[model samples]
Target: MAAPPCDSSAHRAFDFWLGEWNVHTPDGKLAGTNRIVSEYNGCVLHERYDTGRGYSGESLNTYDAGRKVWHQTWVDTTGTLLLLEGGLRNGSMVLEGQTTGADAKLTRHRITWTPNSDGSVRQLWESSEGNGPWSVAFDGRYSRK
Candidate 1:
């Protein structure tokens, strides 16, 4: 079968975010660096995150033809994996997914991608412990360098 078309701009919406960037927590604490490289083949985005705690993770994002949305799968060195699914909105790509299994906790996460007029992009990751409150966890700023 032929590959379906990815009509959603999400395939290119985050194009401005394809670069290296510094990350910070909501409290203004330095996190580390986040690097995103385009696969250049499909609507796929590769991600690498280095945290101040000496931890690192890699993620893969792609456009879902059936769902007509963008989704991301994250896996860290610690063997933790999360599948986040959502779509773009208001120029921001938002994704949210939860965990449930033998080694899973009910955690919800949302990622927002914002591109600025000055050629800078702000990507934010927020999580909620439950249905309680949403707290910003990761903030990544990328500038064309």
Candidate 2:
């Protein structure tokens, strides 16, 4: 038989990440820290990011029971909004959608949660534009501090 539908609450896999987090590059460079919160009966995940580059963005994620997937929307103070729609697989969560703008570019966002030996969670974001190339956008490290 086919697998049962994925629970909407399954998206809560990232709930442990709800708090203050410091982002960094694989090379050990400090990127920024963000504060995350959960809203709407644990259905919506909200995040506010303040990168040292003077860029800030708000991310909102909601689980759709009908589609059995999670849809995430990110909007920055700079008028950049991205919509990502995907689901969980293996041990990672994947979201792929597009950017809504005059330029109209296709955007794919893949996120995965890897636990460190130190009991910390590492979340990575890889994005692709126009199905052209894939690049790492953000990597956040949270220690539940």
Evaluated at residue 28, the lDDT of candidate 2 is 70
* lDDT (10s digit) by residue, model 2, range 73-123: 889878977787876666566677656457665566676666666766787
lDDT of 2: 0.72
Give the TM-score comparing model 2 with the true structure, all chains together: 0.76
- Report the number of the highest-lDDT candidate: 1
Model 2 error, position 108 (Å): 3.8
**Local distance difference test scores for all models:** 0.76, 0.72
Model 1 score (lDDT): 0.76
How far out, in Å, is residue 111 in model 1?
A: 1.4
Model 1: weakest 10-residue lDDT segment is 2-11
Report lDDT (Cα) of residue 125, candidate 1: 83
**Residue-level lDDT tens digits of model 1 in 39-100:** 84756889998875869998899877676777889998777788998877887788888765
